[model samples]
Target chain A: MTRVFAPLACLAMALFAAAPAVVANAPAEATMGLVQRIFYYHVPSAMLMFVSAVVCGTASAAYLFRRSAAADRLASAAGELVVVFGLIVLATGPLWARKAWGVWWDWDARLTSSLLLWLMFAAYLLVRRYGGPGSEKLAGAMALFGMANVPFVYVSVNYWRTLHPKTSVIMTLEPGMRSAFWFCVSAFALLYALLLALRLRLEERRAEAEALFLALDE
Target chain B: MRVAWAILRKDAAVEMRSREIVYTTVFFAASCVLVFAFALVREGRAMPDAAAAILWIAVAFSGTLGLGRTFERERYTDTLRALMLAPSDRPAVYVGKLLGMLVLLAIVEAALLPLIALFFAAPITASPLWLAALLAAGTLGFASVGTLFAAMLVRARSRDVLLPVLLYPITIPVIIAGVRGTAAILQPVPDEAMARFWAALLVFFDVVFVTLSLWTFEPLMTEQ
Candidate 1:
């Protein structure tokens, strides 16, 4: 536990330390003003959400084919991370939207797709928790489908061309803002790795306990 | 192909004898339209604008109900176990189920079209052939994914609820295409190009999901 917490604590500290630089050094957007600052946390959280979903999907594919406890555990952990970061995106998104778009919620393609992706994995976790005996395999299948939807979700913006900003907008940020963004991205990526490792350890311990229980029962 | 036909014939014969699923789904579709009419009438909204969206929502939900009951019948008869245990090609079984679902949903949609037309007083601007093509493509994509997920959910508890929760998120694109295509056909000035685009999207979704479902069905149904 200490081993896991020690590194996570350090990352948390670094994130806090970097938070000020992100706010102070990064130039505010000409349009959205102070609210644009949320972009740092919001974008990184969304990025990690996508990364976690991909990991979940790959690990799910692995579990589906091989039926390994390790793969299932990693997939399960990553699935939870998708929800975690997805919530951050979901929350920060509306706050930014309220400022930028003047509506707390818009049925824009990107926002709707993100919510759908989040719900898809939320359902995945539900199945794992309550689906009884073969839940792992069920959840694995869901993960694969969720992963498959990601590209479609990412592109739905182009397909519909609604209000949400396109990918090119991200590429056009000023250098300092761009670097600040990358720094936050790195910090959140580190956070995701730390959480995944800690979650996987918890899952392994639970598996060991269940195995011991079965042995004792026999 | 022969194996698929035999299963399809067997299910068709059984359905003909009982007509249980057909009646229930058709009734469900009607009820959905009625409920929507009542709800929307109270709100004094543009029912024509909502007509296409309402029709697809009814079909999607009722179709989900049919899929669950179809497998539940297999479970009651222990036929799922028998079929899984049998020495036969599994993808054939999937094809057979997919065919059965397609036929069933088509019937429900057939019943739904006139009801929507009457209730919303919306003119069907596109030709019948074009509308039928869009419906077929959309339902094909929907049932392909529905069949796979329903089969996977067969033994799980709360599968009735799980089916939709699991099914809807993945099938959103199909729903979007279906609604957009239907709207195009029902539009005041029908946009042939837009309708064709949505139809093409539906076809693309059907091809990808059907192929994936067939490849994965055997493994997913297997007890690991």
Candidate 2:
């Protein structure tokens, strides 16, 4: 089934992301100790990345099993969102990495893998465009296989030496830090949900345009 | 079995006699080396790993060229449709076609490896056996994806331009795994540390592409 329409998700996410406590009480450098404030966008962008991949994987599996056009649309929608989330990761990652790691860029495993993943998904987008009528099937297959890298990007931090910090929110966070972090988390998640919703709409328009062109040809 | 074998043998025989892929691929790879060499003359330290990356890049580019050429040959002059109509399960055709492509790529890679070593002045010796295997696996991974996609692109507007667009993006992970694996092995480190990571990646990727390509080929072929 088609997911909820884009406008609705965007509206809901906007409201949720803008709760007063998140924006007004955000731990500014003046108030909260340093390194405590980047949490606002960092975790949210990351959460969105995972959410996008999960959606991509779900739609891909649906398409493979059923081969329905609806499934293809969902997969495409999710794939498009992955690209969006990827851009978020890319923009926000370096900012945080530089602060956390003291360098603008490094060959840290997470950074490299994340960069590779962005390229991989970017490649996914290209593969779909390069594919012709029969490309949907190929795109579906790629979505599934490429999803493997999503987790690799996550766990890759642990695999090798990295400047990116280990996952520490759960293991050790003062309650105050946790509250601010959660605010950032909810805000970014809402932002992601909104963007994802809008992207899926664009995909529908593009798909509809393709169908129209094909019909006119006949 | 005989029917499939016939297709494989015919393909091999043609490649053997024409030597088109080998000649074109070797020339193309050498040209890449020379061009990149002149460009990176100041950065001589770019070395063999860089050479390896360039080597594989040329190999992938040339392999796609060959694949597109092969499909074009089938589309314009040969009997690809007739072969499909032949009494063979299509997966057999997939297997046979993939095998032929693999053999052709292997020949190109074998020739290119030492050249890469010589250019970079790095040893592509027996120590990097796993690295060599990783390169081979990565080639297969790209070939599998390219061969199937090339088949699809044959009917498109610009198959040659379109092939790399589709082929390389999907193959990025393979490139990462391949380059990383090769670099890891060539780093002169103990096998146990990074070996599992690269080997597992190569094996996992190889399995993924081979199986996915096989599964997708029938639908892609039937669509045309």
Candidate 3:
């Protein structure tokens, strides 16, 4: 894992550096003009946010049932990434909505669920931080519950009607925009992977230090 | 099944003896209504759909209080560990705890409903059956997750604060459904179909959450 980290970091940086050029050269959207370009960043972060949530929930389940320390660390790392990517999606979203929807925000299905998902993961991190001893299990339960909640939240809020574009918008993108969008997505995915690896390593080192301290006390 | 029944009976007996949780939780819920009434009322009239929102808000708030106290009793007596060690199924204990929570919240809502109707001029009798179904399903969904999280938090530090922090975001769907379903029924021209739709959604939420809670309760409650 350590050996691959440096090269992965370089590749992610390179992709990220090249992403802006690709996005700029992509054909201007027919209607929304330059503001539509936010889609290149916002949609990718949104996709990765959901992906991070699944990773955290799966790892948390593994930790709970298998009692694997490595799984617990991975869950912690993924949980934090969910919040990070969620922030990017959220911040970039309102900027686009301001131009497109004539309002900074709306309580539509996707917007509401995205905010709630972000809050749930934020709460997950909070429990792990302030819950003291035995908090890991509590945090794991939180992740599992948070993951299970996504659909209910979506369905309930969706009753109010949605203004967010259908996800099919991606599949139907113009040729130039399609390539640019996928380019941005791959860059974001690589960044997500790099961050998860680094965070997991940090958790591993912290656990080691704690164990060593306990041994010294004995 | 018998294990669940016995635990429920035990909780009932304890509450029957003291009536502490019931009396306090109901009063707290009523107070919540009054507070909302003051904020939402204008020219001696409540805001539109204020009754439904207030009713569910009171339920959620007092439900949090009730959940915290119920587990606080077990933690205070150090009996949760004993219950976990008993020769019975773990999910049964979870069901028992969840049933107890539902009962407590039911009493709170029973007292809450008429007060909200009178205060806000909601037509509570317009559709009694749908109202009850919505309340029942919503309460079940909320309490199912609440019971599990509250029980797990029993040993954690600062549990009082942590309970709501962890419980609210997950249970927001229940509150949304409850408030919207009740609002549909309370409207001048009631929309029975909309009410039914929200009620069905609440049932689905209850089914998913209850099953998830039952499955996870054993492992979460196991002290490592």
Q: Which stretches of candidate 1 lie over 4 Å from their true place?
A: A1-5, A153-157, B42-45
Question: What TM-score would each prediction reach against the true structure?
Answer: 0.95, 0.81, 0.98
DockQ winner? 3
lDDT of 1 by residue, A83-170 (tens): 9999999999999999888999987888988998999999999999888889788899899987877666545434665788777867
Candidate 1 C-alpha lDDT tens digits along B100-202: 9999999999899999888887676456777888899989988998998888888998898899989998888888888877888788777778788888878
Residue B117 in candidate 3, Cα distance off native in Å? 1.1
All candidates: interface RMSD = 1.3, 3.5, 0.5
Tens digits of lDDT, candidate 3, B100-196: 9988988898999899988899999999999999999999999999999999999999899999999999999999999999999999999999999
Whole-model lDDT values for every prediction: 0.86, 0.69, 0.94
Residue-level lDDT of model 3, residues A1-218, one tens digit each, is: 98988998999999999998999999999889999999999999999999999999999999999999999999999999999999999999999999999999999999999999999999999999999999999999999999999999999999878999999999999999999999999999999988998998899999999999999999
List model 2 lDDT by residue over A1-218, tens digit each: 14655566666566565754564564455433455455566566666776776777778767766666777777777777777777877787777666666767887776676666666667567667765556676666666666755554444334546666667754566666567667667666666666665666677788799999999999
In candidate 2, the residue pairs with backbone N, CA or C atoms under 3 Å apart (3 or more residues apart, or in different chains) clash, namely none
- Among all windows of 10 consecutive residues in model 1 chain A, the one with the lowest summed lDDT is A152-161
lDDT: worst 10-residue window of model 2 chain B: B184-193
Which should have the higher DockQ, number 1 or number 2?
1
For model 3, what is the error of residue A14's alpha carbon versus the real structure, in angstroms, after optimal superposition? 2.2
